[model samples]
Target: MTQQSLSKFEEHLQDILQYRVEKELLIIKNYPRIIADYDRDLIIELMESLLNNVYCFAEKTITITITLQEKLLIIYVKDDGPGFSKKELLTATEPYYFQNKNSHFGLGLTIVEALTQKHVGNLKIVNSIDGGAIVSAVFAIKVENLH
Candidate 1:
């Protein structure tokens, strides 16, 4: 874990976005400019997994939203795609729970879930009422020198 600025995180996100340029998907980022303590690499991995999963199923746009509430940082990745089925909502975080016939193993959400747990955080998988899939990760923000 290390102290990182959100700008640096955004830059990493841009790099991930570059990889999927051929798909021509629209990505929206909504987050604040603040420093936080976290495992930068793991967080990047979490984002990559989330984005990759969504990118494969999204129709056109994907939205990433981050917000700080109390002492928790909430990160939401949503996609304009066919939302998860009832069973997926319950088992998506389980290892080897693949919904589509892809060459890759179905460990994306499992990895995300593990990383969140490593940070003592939690993960939520749900579908937006309007239409889409939304995956949220919440991590407790560690404040230094509070005294």
Candidate 2:
């Protein structure tokens, strides 16, 4: 590869690494505040992604949990503010899908799903039992999967 190509690749990798590290720090910093004794980094990161983007996320109601089995892993993040409409949830993850001042804006949950799939997982938006929006994921278990 040319020097320019190498420089671009390095920059891309560095951005990804920095993003991951910043997300990890979010989990570690908020652990005690959210849950008592469980370590759900994936779920935490999902919530953080939403909360970080929305200034009023904490003020709004939120809940998260993890469900796991010997062979499966599930992370759920939920919010009780204005939940997404079906059409909204359906396309919210597509990066800047509904942008523009006159259009509805959303965080890239579609991108989030793609990231989940990289871990051999999937993402879905569902209605919470109580009320609100829920982001559920089903992932696989692997030693190296733990970042």
Candidate 3:
């Protein structure tokens, strides 16, 4: 995640989630200060889609966490929902592939994957050991003043 003020991004995320989640439980882990280069609008769109997918399957709570490493930024959106099947894991990000017939265009993960690549990032979807889905978006950030 890149922002002049990352808190603004967090606020934006909370707004979107609050709107979509209605009265559901949401746990947003406080993020530390992180400054990097990123497209604000694109990040917002990416997060919106990710949250939408989580909302689709979430039962009660959703958790959002962000971590910044020396050369990477990782955001994990975890939900207490049914995890993905083996087949879904492989093709979830493929265009026009819908696990649920009534779901959205199946473009949520696709767009996220594309945006991640565009920013030299990676996307991972895994089933949490606690029996939920965890979607992680990892971005490579330029490290300054390397020895």
**Regarding lDDT, does 1 or 3 come out ahead?**
1
| Candidate models: Cα lDDT each | 0.80, 0.49, 0.77
Tens digits of lDDT, candidate 3, 43-137: 77888888877777888888888766666768898888888899999999999978777877788889888988877889999999999889999
User: What is the C-alpha lDDT profile of model 1 across 121-144, one tens digit per residue?
Assistant: 999999999999999999886633
Q: Give every collision pair in model 3.
A: none
- My TM-score estimates for the predictions, one after another, are 0.85, 0.55, 0.84
- Candidate 2 lDDT over residue span 1-147, tens digit each: 011211232233335335543232221111111111222344345545544433233234445455545445565666665666677666767777653477545555755677577657778877666666777767664322221
Candidate 2, residue 104: lDDT: 47
Inter-residue clash pairs, candidate 2 = 93-109, 93-110
Q: How well does candidate 2 match the true structure in TM-score terms? A: 0.55
User: Which 10 residues in a row give candidate 1 its minimum summed lDDT?
Assistant: 22-31
Instruction: After superposing candidate 2 on the true structure, give the runs of residues whose Cα lies further than 4 Å from its correct spot.
Output: 1-47, 53-59, 99-107, 143-147
